[model samples]
Target: MKLCVIPARGGSKRIPRKNIKEFCGQPIIAYSIQAARKTGLFDHIVVSTDDDEIAEIARSYGAETPFRRPAEISDDHTGTNAVVKHAILWFQENGTPVDLVCCIYATAPFVQEDYLQLGHDKLIQSDKSFAFSVTSFPFPIQRALKITQNGGLSAFYPEFRSTRSQDLEDAYHDAGQFYWGSAKAFLQEHELFSNQSLPILLPRHLVQDIDTPEDWIRAEYMYKAIHSSI
Candidate 1:
């Protein structure tokens, strides 16, 4: 069985109630739920959250809230793997064993059904533990710099200071949109960045991390720009 679990806790530090915060017009979490629904790839689409309001909102978007997330795993320190594992365990105990699971972030407003479908197809055909969204870094990370004690800049890779940009290998980072994994992978909490994973590359324009107020504003502008063109 295929299951989609979206982890959205109530305690948000950067932007209060960010999970349900309005992006454009509707709540940001709504975008994720809508994308998951559009894919038509899950036996059950569950929103694993601790907040009552969040659960209600999730239900309105056509996701199941089978059980309230335990308080222990709903804190700031808790990771996405733990939350997905908890949901997997709950389904198993309730006699609903899932073979594949997808964890979509609540704040990922840029998530598209086509990419989610791509991740699903890739995971099903491969032995990888995960097939998650990733995007190439706009700037090469090899020439990165850091601030010194005296507030001066220094190259992180001094050896690559003179290297040509085209000569450097391209780098990519987690798009923070969605992750498709086998039930066993999530339960084992395997390293997502390891070789046992497949990456679904996305264009940089469609990816944005909305953690702070500034980030939210930037995301709003980006979202508007994309939708306007569409």
Candidate 2:
């Protein structure tokens, strides 16, 4: 069986109530739930959260809140792997045997259903433990800069300073949207960014990280630009 697990903790420090905060028109998490529902991929779409309001909102958007996440795993220090492992264990104990699972982020407003389907297709066909969203860096990461403690700038790789941008190897990063993996992979806490993971590349414009108010504004504009036609 395929399971969709969305991890939403209530202790966001940078942006308060970020998980359910409105973006564009509705709660940001609503988009994720809607995308999962639209794909018709998962046997059970569930949201694992610590807050009552989050659970209620998730259910309203057609996701199952089978259990409240434990406080130990709901803190800011908690990691995605721990939250996902908890959900997988819950299913195993409840007699629901899930073969494949996807951990969709609660704040991913730009998530696409087609990519989710694509990731699932890749995961099933390959021996990799994961197939998740990833996107190329707008500029090569090889020539990244850093600010020195002396208030001056320094190149992370000074050797690449004279190299042309096009000559630099292309780089990519986790879009922080969704992660699809086998139930065993989640339970075993396998790393998600290794050779064992398949990359489901997404257009960079569709990827946004909404951590602060400025990020929220940029995301709103980007969302309008792409979704205006729809």
Candidate 3:
């Protein structure tokens, strides 16, 4: 069975109650839950969270919270891989064996059903073991810069310093939205990306990683603009 896991820890240092924080009139996590359910792709939508409020919000959005994440896995220093592993183990112990696993972050409010279906379909069609969303860099990454300790600026890609933006190859970065992979592969490698991994490119407007307040505002505006256009 395909399982979609939304890992939301109680302790959010950036935005308080980030998972349940309102975004465009709905809890941020609700967007992902609704999107995932809209696709009807997963056999189950499980939320693994340490916060009771988050669990409640998740359940309100039609996601299942059969287990509360352990405190050990709810810390800021805890990696998502560990949380995912713990969730898989919890299911195993509960007699529900999952065949495929999709890691969907609770903060990604802009994730759409089409993009998710694309990733799932790609993973199922290809020999690759994993698929995830990505978005093209707004500016040429070759033109990126780094600030030195003494305030001096340095080119991130020194080789491309002399090249023009148009001459540089296109590049993409992980959208930080979601990832899909075989449960067996995830258990064996303890990672979503193995040798066999595919990048599913998404429109830049639909991709936003909300980490800071500024990012949250931008996401809100972008969401409005996109939906209004629709």
Candidate 4:
């Protein structure tokens, strides 16, 4: 069985009720659920959340909430891996053996079905443990600067200060949208950022991390701009 799990716990310190918060005219999670359904890629599309309202909204969007996430793993400090592993274990206990599992972020309003499909295809075709979305940094990370204790600017890499922007290697970050992993890899809690994973590169315009109020405002503007252009 192939499964898609979205871990949306209730305790979002940064943005209260963010999982169900409206974005672009609908609950943000609706976008993730819709994207998963549109791909027609999973045997089951489930939302692993402890919040009753979140579960209700998820089901309303055609996603199943068969089980409530445990309070221990639903806390703020809990990582996504634990939530996904718990979901996998639940299915295994119910006699449904999942082969491939994709964990889609509940806030990923920009997640595209094509990228989800590409991640699935690449994970299946390659020997990698996982495949997920990533996007290049707008600026070269090699010459990044930091503020000193006394408030003076200092170069993180003094040697790279002389390097031209074109000479620096490109850096990419996790797009925080979705992750496709084999059941074995997820169950083993394999690190997602290592070389064992394959990256599905997304355009910078399509990637946004909505973890703060400022980020939320920026994302809303970005979303509006992108949709307007289309």
Candidate 5:
């Protein structure tokens, strides 16, 4: 069986109730649940959360809340792999073992069924242990600058200062959307960013980090631009 696990903790310091906070017209978490369902990929769609409200919201949107995440793994310091491991163990304990698991982020408003399908297909077809979302950086990272303690700017790579932007190698970063992995890789807690993984590149316009309030506003604009009706 294939499983889709969404890790949504309640203690969001930046935006309280962020998992269930309305994005566009529905709760942010709804998008994730809907996307997982739309793909017809997984046998189960589970939401790992500590808050009762979050659990209820997830179930309302057609995701299973088989277990409330323990405080130890629900805290701010808990990494996503740990939560995913816990969910896998839960099913294993019930004699319903899964072969592949997909970790979908609750804050990913731009996630689509086709992208999830691509990640899963890539993971199954490739030798890599995992496949996840990524997008090219809007600007070249080689030209990055840093501010000194005294407020003076310095090039992180002085050699690149003289190079034209077009000459620099293309850079990409994790889209922070979803990850599809074999049960073995996730159970072993292997690194996801290494060469052992493949990336399902997304369009830059579909990628947005909704962390701070400013990011939230920027995401709203981006979302509208991506989906004309929204």
Candidate 6:
């Protein structure tokens, strides 16, 4: 059975109460919950959170919070992999065995049902054990430079210093939105990307990592523009 886990910790320092913050007309987490539900891909859509308020909102959006996340896994210092592992173990102890797990973030308000479906389909169709969304860097990374304290400019990739953008190989970065992986592989590797991992490229407009107020506003605006056209 495929399980979709949305990890929403209560303590958010950058944007206070970020998980429950309103986006468009609903809570920020509502988007991920709705997308997971709409995809109808997983056997269960669960929210692993330490905050009662966030749990309540998650339930209202049709996601189940079978257990409250432990304090250790709910703190800012906690990594997402730890939270996901805890959730998987919680379900395993309860007798509901999971085959695959999708770790969806609460702050990713731009996640769409189609994207989730695509990732799910790819994971099933390919020999890969994991798949996740990514977006290409807007600027050519070959030309990227780092400034030194002595006012010296050095190329991030020294080999690409003399290379033109069009001639350089393309690169992509993690969208920080969602990830899908086999439960067995995750338990063994403790990571989403292993040898058998695939990347799903997403459009720049649909990919935003919301960590600050400015990012939140930009994501909101992008969401509106995308949905308004649809």
> Compared with the true structure, what per-residue lDDT tens digits does model 5 show for residues 1-230?
99999999999999888899988899999999999999999899999999999999999999999999999998888999999999999999999988999999999999999999999988898888999999999999999999999999999999999899899999999999999999889999888889999989999988998898888889888887778866
lDDT of 6: 0.88
Worst 10 residues of 4 by lDDT: 186-195
lDDT of 4 by residue, 102-216 (tens): 9999999999999999999999999999999999999999888999999999999899888889989999999999999999999998888899999999999999999998999
On the 0 to 100 scale, the lDDT of residue 187 in model 5 is 97
Off by over 4 Å in 6: none
Clash counts for the predictions, in order = 0, 0, 0, 0, 0, 0
* TM-score for predicted model 5 compared with the true structure: 0.98
- Per-prediction TM-score: 0.99, 0.98, 0.95, 0.99, 0.98, 0.94
Clashes of 3: 0
Candidate 1 residue runs with Cα over 4 Å from true position: none
What Cα-based lDDT does every candidate model obtain? 0.95, 0.92, 0.88, 0.95, 0.93, 0.88
RMSD of 6: 1.5
Instruction: Extract clashing residue pairs from model 3.
Output: none
For residue 120, model 5's alpha carbon misses the true position, in angstroms, by 0.8
**TM-score winner, 1 or 6:** 1
In model 5, the runs with Cα more than 4 Å from the true position are none
Candidate 3 CA-lDDT value: 0.88
Q: Candidate 4: where is the Cα deviation over 4 Å? A: none
For residues 1-230, could you state the per-residue lDDT of candidate 3 as single tens digits? 88999999888878888889999999999989998999998888999998889999899999999988888888889877777778788888888898888899999988889989999989999888789988899999889999999999988889988888889999888899998888877777644554588998988988888888999999999999989988
Candidate 4 collision pairs = none
Between candidates 1 and 5, which one is better according to lDDT?
1
Better of 2 and 6 by TM-score: 2
